[model samples]
Target: MAKTTPATRSLAHAGIAFDVHVYVYDPGAERIGMQAAEALGEDPKRVLKTLMARVDGKPVCVILPSDREIAMKKLAAAFGGKSAEMMASADAERLTGYHVGGISPFGQRRPVPAAIEVMALGEPYVFINGGQRGLQIRLDPRAAAQLLGAVSAPLVA
Candidate 1:
């Protein structure tokens, strides 16, 4: 078995079922999302990435398809904020303790609100990073919503 992260350990303790996938990571690449999808042989749409953003001076997590960008205006509206801006990569790394390509919402310096777009609809499963590069965790979205205190919204445009 792969070593469990604090985040994944907590998740497992909560009885959340997940699958771990590992791959060879290319540290020099820019688009880690696409790389994750390619490595796992999963469709980009089914593989989501977590992004950190500042909304009204507070940090929020946006989970969306690996292939698309978050719609700032819609995000702001959904969260009842005036505006939203992408946080600096360095800030994200510091807050999440993971590199830009491996920002998993499950483990963070703190539990920030996770806002997902409606486009990410599916049954009970979705793919998210497993707190490291070239690693991913597949679990139920409902479990994610409950564990991470995430709110689902139609934030995708």
Candidate 2:
């Protein structure tokens, strides 16, 4: 796998410190994040999953623990909307310019409102997708949120 990706480049450009970790990606895994966490031998809470969603029809990005599910109502409220839903996979792929399993909040083709789970921010470090399957970027969750201008909230169910 290539060591450099748009996600890594974005972090480098922003001067954020991070480490890249590569793992065996399971295409058939029902839960990508959980698979990633297991592959990395990290706690599920430390592996963040990037999700593309729509809040009142507007695109948004959400980051939360791999083991949790998003509360749609809370997600909508987080963005000051009344309703929210997961974006269509095709739309998400198009908007982020990445495949479903490889999508990363960083270096998205189109930037949008983003949120990070409040609980995740407490971790010393978290692993997020590195713009490709089988790849993750480890860094301080606080730094990731700050860099993405993501609002911190209780986003999980």
Candidate 3:
């Protein structure tokens, strides 16, 4: 077993079961999840990505497939907000207590409202950042929304 990340610890405490995956992390990889999909030899759709954003100026977490783009208006609407925008990388890091490429929806420094793109729900399991680069945690997608208090919505553009 590998050393537990904040993400892993959080999940364990929450009583969620998961499998950890590791791969060589290339420094300066622009799209970490896509790089993870390639390195793990998995479909890009199974690798989820976490994005931190502001819906009505309140920080929120958005989970979507690696290959998709977030639809800000739809995201805001799901949250009953007037607008939504991506948080700056620095803000994301500060709020999530992890680097931009490794921000997990679990174990955030502050618990914020979250949304999971509806498509991820159909996946039997999904890989999400495991609190650091080069690592991911595969788990049932519904756990993200059910246990993490995230609403599932059509949040991808």
Candidate 4:
């Protein structure tokens, strides 16, 4: 796996400290995030998943733990919208310029409103996609949230 990616470059440019971890990606896994957590031998709560969603028709990015599911209503409230739904995979790929299971909040094709689950922010460190499959970036969750301008909210169900 290449050590550099748009996600890593973005963090480097911002001077945010992070570490890269590579694992065998299981494309057939039922849940990509959980697969990643198990492969990395880390707690599911410390492995965050990036999700592309729409809030009242406007695009938004959401980050939450591998073990949790986002509450759509709470997602909408987080972004001050009345409704929310996950974006189509094709749309998410186009918007983020990343394949499914490899999207990263740090370096998207376009920047959108982003939110990080409040519970995740309390973790000492969290692993997020590194803009590529099989790659993960570990960093301080608070720093990650700040760098993404992500709102901290109770997004999980």
Candidate 5:
């Protein structure tokens, strides 16, 4: 197992139980999320991809299934914002203190408002980035939402 990152440590500190999954990362892979899913031999639907966005000019997170696309309008509505747009990769990295492909919903330098894809809330378990490339954390979806303070919404289409 890899050394504990902020994401895992935060979950641990919160007394949350989860499984750590590490897999080889193919830098040449076309999509980071799909790469992780394939490498881990898991359904992409059960894996999540974290995205940074600006909602009404505030940093926010949108977590959704690897195979899904976020609906910007729904995301904005979820947070009671008039507008929401994906943040530039560089800006996202700067804001969350994690590189673009490694952003986790947990353990941000400054936590932000976040929303989860509605369907993810009901999954038995979900795998998400672990604050770095090649590491993933699997946990009960419900617990993750609570820990992330993520509101559930139809953010993905």
Candidate 6:
């Protein structure tokens, strides 16, 4: 597709197939995850959104379903950290090279610790941002970890 980013390109090279979907973005909207789910005509619980947080002062990315909220205590416990808080949007953009609403586990500016709820990977289907708002990449859950270097764990409450 669009000469994919380094992360996506690497995925392709590794034989990880993916489908790209793009939609109209509503910049004024606050619920981008819901927007994407609506545009894609998929159940919100089956789709996921990426969140950037600082775990013990280091950037980390956590992927969870749009219908759920991150359990900070669970996250902190899993990582052996005392605290985890959402990072500022500016810091998120600066570190990930993607807007807060459009952050993907792939192609981040740096290799941040990534965690995906174990439930999200129960099935083969998963969708994530394609490095831009209104754009998404659909692929197998296994491919996500292989491509994004993510750790699939139990962090969703």
* Model 1 regions more than 4 Å off: none
Q: Where does candidate 4 clash, by residue pair?
A: none
Which model, 1 or 6, shows the larger lDDT? 1
Clashes of 5: 0
TM-score for each candidate, following the candidate numbering: 0.91, 0.99, 0.96, 0.99, 0.96, 0.90
* lDDT accuracy of residue 39 in candidate 1: 83
lDDT of each: 0.80, 0.96, 0.90, 0.96, 0.90, 0.80
* Candidate 3 residue pairs in backbone clash: none
Better of 2 and 3 by TM-score: 2
Worst 10 residues of 2 by lDDT: 2-11
Q: Please, what are the lDDT tens digits per residue for candidate 3 over residues 9-109?
A: 99999999899998887777888878889999999999999999999999999999998889999999989999999999998998889988778999889
User: In candidate 3, which residue ranges exceed 4 Å CA deviation?
Assistant: none
Worst 10 residues of 6 by lDDT: 1-10
What pairs collide in candidate 2?
none
lDDT of 4: 0.96
Candidate 4 clash figure, as a count = 0
Which portions of model 5 miss their true places by more than 4 Å? Answer: none
